[model samples]
Target: MRNYLTLFLLLFTLQLSAQNHVFVETESFEDKGGWVIDQQSFVVMGSSYLMAHGMGRAVKDASTTIKFTKKGKYHIWVRTKDWAPFPKGPGKFQVSIDGNPLKQVFGESGSDEWKWYDAGEVDIKTETIKLSMKDLTGFNGRCDAILFTDVPKFTPPNKLEELSAFRKKLLNLPDSPVAAGHFDMVIVGGGVAGTCAAVSASRMGLRVALIQDRPVLGGNNSSEIRVHLMGDVDKNYYPKLGRIVREMDNGDPGNGNPDAKEYGDARKTSIVKAEKNISLFLNTYVYKVEKQNDIITAVVGRDIITNKETRFEGSFFADCTGDGTIGYLAGAEFRMGRESKAETGESLAADKADNFTLGTSNLWASLPRDTVTTFPETPWALQFSDEYHIDNTKADWEWETGFGNFNTITDAEKIRDHNLRAIYGNWSYLKNHKSQKYAKQELAWVAYIGGKRESRRIIGDHILNQMDIQEGKQYPDGSVTATWTIDLHFPDAKNSKYFEGQEFFAGTKHIKVAPYTIPYRCLYSKNIQNLFVAGRNISTTHVAFGSTRVMRTCGMMGEVVGFAAYLTTKYKTTPRGVYQDHLPELMSILKGETIEAQP
Candidate 1:
């Protein structure tokens, strides 16, 4: 009897394993149509998903092809979230199998945790079928993944590790990584500095790979984020360094989706594409790095649209990612927020070290219409007191938040969402309240991309402090000239009275200082050999960073690093080696001299 029971159990297990199951990643759909690929969340169901940001108008349907084997009753499950679980959410969506709509709808049903919702079983008759997600509300409805299974025992995995493994097996991912080709230098960021670095390096006859996480170049300056290019470029030191920036700048002010040319999005793309030696990979986000000892071997990036992974191998690498994402993954030491007065004897340093870095901004603008406009009441969103209500038509750099204990990188989704709620809530109050100031105004645009001011400071060979900027302390190896004053942003005291440690508006305080040059030593990782850095993440005390964090200064830094990277490839030397033994060689490049003719 025991032997018979064992045989029956073994057969049952095999049957379950052989049951038909189909897992479809919504973001991997061939024709995403009008849906936006939302990979911003570190806290997501899978790697990333698609969002229907129709803003109340139904977006075009996103559809994909699927093949089914066992033509029987198959249970359908979808992974999604109801953004506002407390009150009735605005977003709602439904899935259709083989042109047949599911009985139950999704998006408005689940909570913050992305769990599977049973969308009722369907009888399968054909081997091939079309699956699509139809949006009901023009609001931000999202879809992560869809699962269809014949076996009753099969359940979708919720744990990340288990889900990842399941996805790999189901998707038939290769055991080996995909090679994305070799390069002399790989600059990961695509912001002002990273873009300049790639251009400079490519122009100097070096093979370069420029990876940007967004669809367009210019991190904050891009129309998606809409921050204008600030600080002076080509004024001091290497005049040729800012040439690329000049070509790319469209000179349009204010932030919105008025037109593509306003932010020079097309112009930047054209310039980068024109470079013979530069391979521009837009919409690719780097998540991992492989290192041997202190040398970085390769970086791994995922295609935001296709959900494909690629390994980017390079002889030299640059951490131009504003958040120091690359450096952090490769185990590089970094600092966050203000330092203690005892650590650095700067007058601006706080008495105690605290995690209080500069805040991120979500700027919004309102367009005045001839006829009166009404905004939907967002009672579920954050509320403001009558006295503190800002009856304004636009929000700019000062409209910032995310100081306090919020981890900029990890808690990014929450921060951006808060800004969205704030924008909607503020507009609703303005239009509906007894105050008739904004009755004729309509929200033209609100940024989905949060423009961050500060984050991780990757430690380099030289840690520039407040005195370095204030005293104009010159380093023999200084390469990039930083002209901005010792400027710092803090939560507005008036705004803080309401939010307290979570103020969304910021106030700037500046002290004029003579322009000082930033040392090349501050542009490379201290321990991570062969890894260079630029932009806001470069080694600097919180006080010093205040002056050096502007986009143009970052561009100059990138230009310097790009030249140094060429030297590294030519001489086959590490970043430290270039600094100690070949300091003049780097200076020669900054001085706009030929590499071979340098003394």
Candidate 2:
């Protein structure tokens, strides 16, 4: 009998080794279920998925628990989506091993790729081994595939594999008794646009608060990506962008050669030190938008450090959330990608239907070549060419990947993974593995600050189309301005899937538009009355967005929305009312404090 029992236990142990006893697989709470839906995407491969929503997880909690006899080494790993690393996650949740809080195994503050976590085990003092969630402060997160297997039976870490980098996940924010009950205005995004909005509004005698996810000021320019700010400031002569610009690179950090790569990241401290009235919420994300009777009554902000969730109530709100999360939540109208050519009649428009991942570009530099560095080559993407009629060097501050082949949802992981793989592969060639331009080179900078080109666009009163941009159409209610040439990155830019029998692809181009006016109607929500949108997500046809998607115009859009909110409240009127009667007032706020309008 004893021999038979031993054999049975041995068989059970072998089965456990074969299966990891999968438990949870979901997205970071940062997405708030929007990314999982059609509005956004979480495209990845080789994993189970669940949609996380409503302060609850999508996956069923596990009823099965593993019982351990002796205390030994163990681990817990959470699968990740690809796009998480691009925008990174937000929200402060926790991981616990045997009821003990895991310091910072995972959180929504930063981005990570698919990997297992080394969750050191605890002593088995009780009858059963218990693993559970702890420090689950704030709200948002999903665990679709929750597995409880012996930690020793996990896969070895792959070098090329991308894992999320987070120091710690504080589950809540610091306690604050809600900053009064209301304010004149609340600005989201804290980048150049948000800062300008706050400074200008505050100077206009309005109480304002600027919320930002990063600890520093200047959104993309905040020492993160090291990209430069090129807009209607020095080029068009605006005091608002000029004052902020002088504080940053009085000369030109993004100009020159070696210096060009590090300009955006260097301007972080400059904007913060320059703006005073802007009560900056560094590292705080506006996760939820509360609406009461058609107006956004409060903007719910979560602080990952102190684990605090505060309701920032205001008479008005400006969405610079970048992804347009605030506007989407507030019932704003928005669209993503291009329509079929049959619908728009443009040659550049798509012919078929599919999810598009307007991917990010992570550029690299090898300075003062002396030593050789080896890298892997990407079998998929090809070298830059002119036949495709695209600028090979234009992808400087903003390098893009993953537009042609990858799906935007479920395959987002694959999209981001493929992008990173291609980038490193190309870098290897530059290093010594493969060579497109150099003989022998050195490594200068691997841009940690990734420029994410597209995701969500907020729907507004007017959806700007390709024709309007081409004609340089003007509106009586025009408030903000856009200046990038009508740039359209087609469905196939680098991948060969679009054009058959091709290994490389040159990017597509569209007719350019000189600087043009963007109407004020493009800021407020088409569905929700008081909700406003700023940033890349505003209503623009995929063709028109190619040009207006630039952050410069997005900032100006934020400024316009902020001022509009002020006037809307002052007169107790609709955005249209503020626009029609307040034309001179609106331009007075945005017009040539320095330079010329769009010709």
Candidate 3:
């Protein structure tokens, strides 16, 4: 008979069916950093995941031998808030079970704290066996916990269950039911771009619906895996985008999770809901697109809380799925991954254009301050020259990428990890080992925002090209704008023959023209006439996307798409017509609005 604890865990998991199976540590284990006993699902060490150091590993990468029994149909789920720290620049983690190394099962050895996933299935040849984990330096690793349960026996009711009354109402909709539901606009994705898109478009006299996959509004910036919002808007050198950009950045606490009133852009769940025009749909993903000819008639969004599908038809739709989901589902033409130089004439393109694009991140962040020294100094402590790595503690973050290949998953997960790794790796370089070590400032804050760069590029009327960007091209029908500089990623930063590595040091290269106008032609579907697209997936050549893919730009583009949709509904005219003959009217509406939001 299974223990009562197991029974309780099963029942409790069924109750909170949507969440990851959580197994708290009843007994404190210091050998594993006590696991923090956090109340919040992802609350690392009961304070902030970025406290003292950015990531939490297997305490100090201690050797752990676990024996597994109870074989039939048992799948092990390892939910870790884990990161593989680098020895010098980037390191790998090694695990072995049943004589097969975990790298074989997990595909790669590196990850950015991807949690609540299958560590791999355990096939029991023998009743008992040992699973071992050791970092590249044989010292540092981040492990939250491993949960083993009978996959088949752990099933909840066959029928989907509903959580809230709102979800119950949505669940009853038929497959193609046309909802009388009227939303001013439905904005998908809640990243920096989506957040700004919802706020901006709503300010233009419309009820807004914001749908996100995660519970939090700030996809990357939420407490899930800390990443501070950084870009030209950090007031680095660009100052014009200051107000709207700074609106998100409430300031930094220089400490643990500060109050919303304190510092840091508190884009947490509650804060996002306060906007009246913005109806926050947390944990809802658009799984289906209802189409009428070329236009997206409605979006069938899945409310994860109740497992119900609700169709939301709006005046206009914005495809900010980051993966170009809405347009793709609606059969709007789209492109995936990097195009060869021959394909787009992009300078950084490879011989053959591959769809190995970047995707979402699973991240981790920490505050390794100068105050306490309890943070472990592992045998894998990175020793580096002034260039590759810096040598101090405060700013020295040992996060970088080594595992996962770009061939599979189109490098989506890898891109996410690399971007996150860069955050920590860049911090370490600034903190300790460098010519500018003396100039290093205290690592003020690590971001909850995971910076993901590339994804699906939705096909549109015109693909923005690098040469056009170089020449500062403008269109008469231009509705959106791109102020950021053009910064392209290299084909291979690591010089791999088959796989292109990441660009080590890259930035917004100043364009010949700043704040260049983006044409309305580029906003709508080339193939699907009524469909609209936005975000990093807009019609842009590979090189041009490098500049326009930033979240702020995506937000601006989303707003424009919404506006075009609004015009189409109000004047009963095609979006192209508004640009061709009625330009004065469109400009009038866009110019008159000041963003005053209410909940």
Candidate 4:
């Protein structure tokens, strides 16, 4: 009887200890090696994942050390997707435990949806073990998170809601967000417009918080995207409006320049750091908003790498995210597509209201090498023949996708993947089929970050239309002269012939227009009381957006918004109240006049 009691107690203790499991997020790895953290699909996928973007060659392995509570046999599961499901995906990789590679390969499954792939069972001999991801074919292989469980028949949740809850329970995240301090104004983007707004408001004696999701400052003009600044600055109604813009402009390096120095990422970062009143937060993505009645009180942002959430409280807020993400989260009225001529009464408006917006661009360039270089055949990529292929060494703005059929925000990942297919397939044809013609040229750079043009436009008190540009309409609150031609893009006829709905090339018609000052009424939300908007997401019809969406013009609009924020702080009023009550005070500031000495 004594031996039976002792055995029963030993069995109970072993059962309790066997319930140990460890969850590891790939983005939090100390050394990421060649894998890059991609947050573009986080809104849909629930979290950021690591992608191995090596064009076609295998990249360096990503390794990390994990400490386990109980050492024994455990089931390994990895969250990943095949990405391109045709026979099998090109993105193939393996997992290694303590330098021992697993037998089952990942990212070659039949389904394209993101799900957990069982990586078989392994015996963990020690409390601490080294785990690594080895890329077999580096065509954008990705991994979200890894799980090690000792419990039999244990599986992680697949649905987003359940997975989120499970992550919080396992990772021990706080229920309430950690406070990130209160500010006079909180700007939610780090593009040229948001940067200008932060600097301008900080100089005018207002505490500002500038939040950017990416590492760099310039949005499209950043080194990662490599788009040049367009439209004329300092040539507008208010000359002082674009002085900040001029300071950040790094002379046109063209659209798809391979040189990183030409875009000047460090230059923009230094400028924002110099301002004492501005607090800049980089690599932080805002996902939640707190509102009181009609005004936004605070926003909650999560660090992309650390997964730590921080709440930013502010008196006023700005929506400078190019996709109008902040305004959309606040339930602000917004439009996503073109307005019919019958509705807007503009000649350039579409005959029928439809879901047609400008497409996104993923640019690429090739450099001339001294010796002949070879590229592998991409059978999984979009196939092209000699009869229908873009016979070019480099791609520019013309290489675009997701025009009339696709949603720019929801279908962003698919659109980017389609562009990649087109790029690789076209280059393959040129290299293999027409090698004699282009033997010396090698693919130098291809932008994994897509340069987006149009998305949700937050409605303001005034919506600028094409007639405003054509007639040169001037308003009392007019500021920021837009000089770019009214440009709209459509699918290229030749490429559409081969790939109808998935056309990658774009064709545009540029209509000349006189420089016109955009109204300040178009920069603030009509319904959302304290929200100010700038960048490409400001209040503009699809027709007028063609002219007002340029970088320099968007920067000037930001400058005006900063000045308006100053007035809001001084008078203790909303954004709409500034235009209705204190128009003169706003104009005086735009004219470069100080308001009763700087605070």
Clash counts per candidate, in order, are 2, 42, 30, 0
Error of 4 at 277 (Å): 0.9
lDDT of 2: 0.52
Number of the top candidate by lDDT? 4
lDDT of 4 by residue, 68-108 (tens): 87788999999999888876778898999988999988998
Clashing pairs in 4: none
Q: What 10-residue stretch in candidate 3 is worst by lDDT?
A: 43-52
Q: What is the C-alpha lDDT profile of model 3 across 408-487, one tens digit per residue?
A: 22334344345445545444444443424334234333333334556567777678887766666766665555666765
- The root-mean-square deviation over C-alpha atoms between each candidate and the true structure, in angstroms, is 4.4, 12.6, 11.1, 5.7
- The window of 10 residues in a row where model 1 has the poorest summed lDDT is 590-599
Candidate 4 achieves a global lDDT of: 0.88
User: TM-score, each model?
Assistant: 0.92, 0.64, 0.59, 0.96
lDDT (Cα, tens digit) per residue for candidate 2, span 1-599: 66764574565447545643333323223222231211113112222233322211122222224455444444555543222333443223445545566565444534455444444444445546544443232112333233344546554222221111010111112344355347767878776666666665665556777887666666555444455565554443233433433444434456223454355444444454455545657666665678876678888765533334567887777777666767766766666566777877656567864455366554545555565444333332333333432322223633455464543433443443344444444544444423444445444444433455666777777878777766778777755656777665644533555334322222556466776777777777776766667767777766667777765666666666666666766677766667667767666656544322210
3 or 4, greater by TM-score: 4
Off by over 4 Å in 3: 1-54, 57-184, 219-275, 302-310, 340-342, 345-352, 355-388, 392-449, 491-512, 573-577, 580-582, 593-599
* Candidate 1 C-alpha lDDT tens digits along 1-599: 66765574566446547877788988888788778877776434447788887644578999999987668889888988887554656678888887788887777663766777877788888888899998887567788889898878567777675576566556767756689899999999999899999988887778999999889999888888888877777567665566766776778586554444678788788889998899999888898899898889999887777667789999999999999989999999999989999999999998999988887888878777888877677665667667877767788788887876577777776677667767767777787883467778777777777888899999999999988888888889988877888778988898888878657878988888777889989999999998899999999999899999988888888888888887887788988888888888778777777665212
